[model samples]
Target: MQQRFYDQVPAVVLGYDNALEAYRSDKFASFPVQPDPGGVIMAQNGVWGYYGATPTAAAAQSTGSNTGLVVAVVGGVLIVLLGGAWLISRRRGARAEDRE
Candidate 1:
């Protein structure tokens, strides 16, 4: 509903529901348009970039997908190792009790 400009081109903020239609009507209609799950619409010079709900804020954030993946893997390995250690300790405790 808000009017904005990019590179001197007039534009508006489009909701996800109407983004497709608006995009189709633009000069960049020939370009492939896809819906952004982040709920943002950026259009200028026949090209669109989606930044999700907070367009300005999202644009500044880094996805960090690769970094996230690495962290998750390392965390999983640590969990498994700790669990194994706990089980070994419990088994040893049981053996010591039986000997007593």
Candidate 2:
């Protein structure tokens, strides 16, 4: 049980020396340890767990490509303008025919 507990729980939770002491006192089982927020127990590379630093604003912003977003916005504007022009031209043609 002692070996299993040590294998399952990281020493960082209570610090190595404290963890050993807790185990000796039979208090380790009841000690509260926070769960991993990311829900990742083990990494693909066989690493015990992920301990990565939080990303900065600049790093987060650079991950995505803005080209697609810009293209979509430009395409939407062109469609609206072209539709408006077509509607105006059709109205003018109808007016000219009525005057004939």
Candidate 3:
């Protein structure tokens, strides 16, 4: 059914704010209407969820925290240095054996 196809559409993807802004820009014209259903996200007392045909910003899932990104970079650098030292040691040992 047509309704099922619409169920997959995200409101932002369909240009919700853009449409409203465009319609409001023309003061002399009546706002263009969207008869099709859409979803929206909202929060009630900090309990957030999506409703209707629009998804709320707080509703669409958020992955890992960004606060620890600096730590991750530092850890990665230490790992690379350790790996480089191991590689140099292996090469030096091979060269010493060749001289014998």
Candidate 4:
């Protein structure tokens, strides 16, 4: 049923300040009405997330530079290297114990 589908969908509410910012943007044109300044903006599309009253300068900088992807790649490489080193050490320790 339609009610069941809606009940299972995730949603979020944006505070008035953030709602106003989203309302003014062309990107958020799907919003049906002009949200009240003192009220909340409910997600009609059943999407779940948060948005601040205004985009932060740090977010803008990081997005344009693809910093998150770079950081993730570096972190992943570090984890793999550490895991390999740990495995090698464990194997060496086991061999030493076997020989004693």
Candidate 5:
């Protein structure tokens, strides 16, 4: 295990599996010795914030998959609204032409 210093805290990257599943097993039980893509950190009798924790990437731990997903959802809604507007305008024009 390689020692890594972060925020002046000495830490180690563990080789455990993903935390999502382990955590899913029992969130309370998985409180310590978490899992992440970076790996797992089995604390060796040391106490610190998130010590003996799992390695999770910022993206992986996010509520959403990515910022792009936010944009995609917004864009899709806008596209649907715009398409409906265009269809309505076309229908109105057709009616106007028929009246003329």
Candidate 6:
């Protein structure tokens, strides 16, 4: 079993006796054994586990694309709308210096 993909999802690299015979068959009712170190396992639908390798090269040069999370959420909503328009223009310049 090989079929790799990783950050783009879809993975399956089974080996240790076909991942313990597909984690004792029954189509993996609950197969969780991922302590990492080249013997992962997290079976379920879409099967995203059992990776021993093939995910290097800077994690396959990820271009999964969120465009840097939409340019960091549009630069954090333009720094909270320029810090709320500099605190509403310093509260309208302290209400025009309290009407002089």
lDDT of each: 0.56, 0.55, 0.52, 0.57, 0.57, 0.59
User: How would you encode candidate 4's per-residue C-alpha lDDT over 2-100 as one tens digit per residue?
Assistant: 566567863533233444334445233233322343444454333222333344355345436678899999999999999999999999999999999
Query: Candidate 6, residue 34: CA error in Å?
Result: 32
Clashing pairs in 6: none
TM-score of each: 0.36, 0.39, 0.34, 0.37, 0.37, 0.29
From the highest TM-score down, the ranking of the candidates is 2, 5, 4, 1, 3, 6
Among the numbered candidates, top lDDT falls to: 6
lDDT of the structure predicted as candidate 6:
0.59
**TM-score of candidate 6 against the unseen true structure:** 0.29
Residues forming the 10-long window of minimal summed lDDT in candidate 1? 24-33
Ranking by lDDT: 6, 4, 5, 1, 2, 3
The clash numbers for all candidates, in the given order, read 1, 0, 8, 0, 1, 0
Model 3 stretches astray by more than 4 angstroms: 1-66
TM-score: the better of candidates 3 and 4: 4
| Residue 72 displacement (Å), model 1 | 0.4
Worst 10 residues of 5 by lDDT: 21-30
Please list all clashing residue pairs in model 4, or write none if there are none: none
Which pairs clash inside model 5? Answer: 14-40
Judged by TM-score, which candidate is best?
Answer: 2
Cα-based lDDT at residue 99, candidate 1: 100
Greater-lDDT candidate between 1 and 2: 1
Q: Residue 48 of candidate 6: its Cα lDDT? A: 50
**Which lDDT tens digits does candidate 6 get at residues 2-97?**
334543555444434545434433222333445545454644333555433234345456558788899999999999999999999999999999
Candidate 4's C-alpha runs over 4 A off are 1-63
* Candidate 5 or 1, higher TM-score: 5
